[model samples]
Target: MAVQPVWHFNRSALAAIALSTLQSGLAQAITLMAPRQMGKSEFLQYDLLPHAEEHGWRVRYFGCATVSPRALTRRLQEALSDFAAGEKWLMRQFARLAGQHAATARAAFPERLVQELAQLRNEKKPSLLVIDDVDRVLQLAGGDTLLREILRAFAGTNGQARLVLSSTLTGHHQGLPALLQQQTTVLTLPDIGDAFVHHLVGQYHQLTRTKREDDNPFGKLSPYQGITWGQVDEGIMQDAFNRLQRIPYYFRALVEDLVLNPERAPAEALQVQLARLQRHRVAVLSWEEMSRLDRLLLTEVAKGTRQFYGDTLRQYLAAQTGAARVSTSQVQSSLKKLMRNRVLGQEADGRYLIIDPHLAAALSVTDKA
Candidate 1:
């Protein structure tokens, strides 16, 4: 089959809501919070940004995920300086030179940023500045300083520069609310709803309708070898969505797998996807950071062990750690660290569970029946 066009779920409604919130004068800043790979950045770039631009707002986007603390100001200056020149050709040339000067861009960053913001403020059109992955900078050494500088610059714009920030989760830094220093509104990027799944079902049919019999991916011995793309339908796609925990990234992966091997059952394809996630760099790094006791606790939780202090688990912990005896105190200490690290999360009923879905699945492989 030929390569399929990238499918997109237009979040124009949500964009309208966010922009309306900003224009209502209730909040000068809005923060979008959602888990990673939940389309936070897509909404900002594809939906929200274009919607604001269409309404005659001047916009700039700065992503913090790839930049260090030192590069923060320089990067923002580049984004701000995009609007510095009067002519389109002049703007393009300035942007090119800005890219070339990134390494030595520090010395003149502040002054340039001030000039850019002043220019933006002087413009009659409203400004929208999106800072993606804003929470990450808070974890860096000089992040607080950078945030304060940003706050000072935009806050001084007298509401001319409307700010929209995106992060995996909110309140990464305790001073975040004060740092923005405005009536900041927090919004969650909603899940890719059922409509998108239906759209994918249609897209899959379009992409696979012309597949030749000789190009089938299934082996003669495979149970689904005789199954065809025509057998995949909206119900199958919806089931696949739920099976993948309603995450868009994984759902897209499933569709891609189907485009190559249309006969694969959603569950079987999902297992392959989950297995890949088990070996993902993030999952590997997280696993490497765990202590033996931490690893043991993780496995126990994955197995639905709620009673952390129970005698049976204490014995298991003692056996695993080669300790004379294990106490409730030790278990509690490790659990606290795991929770703080976000390796584990507590539900409303006080049950501790793994936060990352794939990590949970990988560790659960050793669970007893």
Candidate 2:
């Protein structure tokens, strides 16, 4: 969000919606889902953290991005040392990190881990495990098992521990929403401060010396064909916000296309930029409607550049189709389809690409459930 004079919106309201959703006990965890950069972290750091602190919840904040199953275990071990009582399961984690040769450290630690975690209950303080980008790392480890581990490990009314996992997967990540819906309470981030858009417009215009009222520069370019958005109209603005509000990364990407790249301003280039956004919205919306197997294939391909095959796809998907065996021919067709839709793309190297950062994030959830 850009800084502006004369406040017009209270962005904190978005955070309030998330804060109120927190619950104690074996009660379902609260999953903060929204678009990237919409302040998912801000909601955690500023709103939830403060309340958790007031409630005396010890926070072991972990960012799931770039974390794998192995990496995740390490981070959890470290976090245990940070917030849990003395003599935690951490030494065992350290030995695990040291490798299997360290036999003593190989001792079962879950019992000790549970004991130390239970200790948080007696502290005159409430402790909450705050994990950010919960979705991103989950995809890396490849499933919702991490979610089950976290909940099983820490979620309970013992008031000793609570889980608050947040990510920008609400409008995207078709897989996570349903997965989370099981033991996780769902709450659409309520409409933000009404002034958010107006304030943003004012700030942008003031900074750039442009305004919707004073001038509609794109109005000149509106004559072009295939432009999904044009003219800075209320409808256009709302659409941008719809994408931006659900996923903050879209906004950043939008600003880059609209304001940052003035060198290629207007006409074909401009249309292409907006077309980029529209494609992502389509993929996200469409992916949300896909079956679990189909969605998981997307999740796998999205991990990085790699050719997916029948065995690989089957390993991830519950059912297999004659045409979708994921062999060379099948992957080629799937890649072609994902690319045609503009969600999965390809590079000069011939590997499929994911042009949208938001989609990548969706593919990467650790499991808000």
Separately for all candidates shown, the number of backbone clashes (residues 3 or more apart, or on different chains) is: 0, 21
Among the numbered candidates, top TM-score falls to: 1
TM-score of each: 0.72, 0.53
Q: What does candidate 1's lDDT look like per residue over 1-369, in tens digits?
A: 112237777789999899888877767788887766777887788888888988888776778887877776556555655644322427556656678655544666555555556666667888888889887776667766766666566656666778898866421222234544343577777777999898888777776754543345543354334665566778877887776667788788888898787667767887887665545514323676778898899888888888999998899899989997889999999999887876776765687767665566556755753
What lDDT tens digits, residue by residue, belong to model 2 across residues 179-287? 6767666544444543555555555445444433234555654222342323433445456666443444344345445544444433433356445554555444376
Candidate 1 lowest-lDDT run of ten? 169-178
Looking at model 2, residue 37 earns an lDDT score of: 50
Q: lDDT of all the models against the reference? A: 0.71, 0.53
Lowest summed lDDT over 10 consecutive residues: which window, candidate 2? Answer: 1-10
How far off is model 2, as Cα RMSD? 12.0
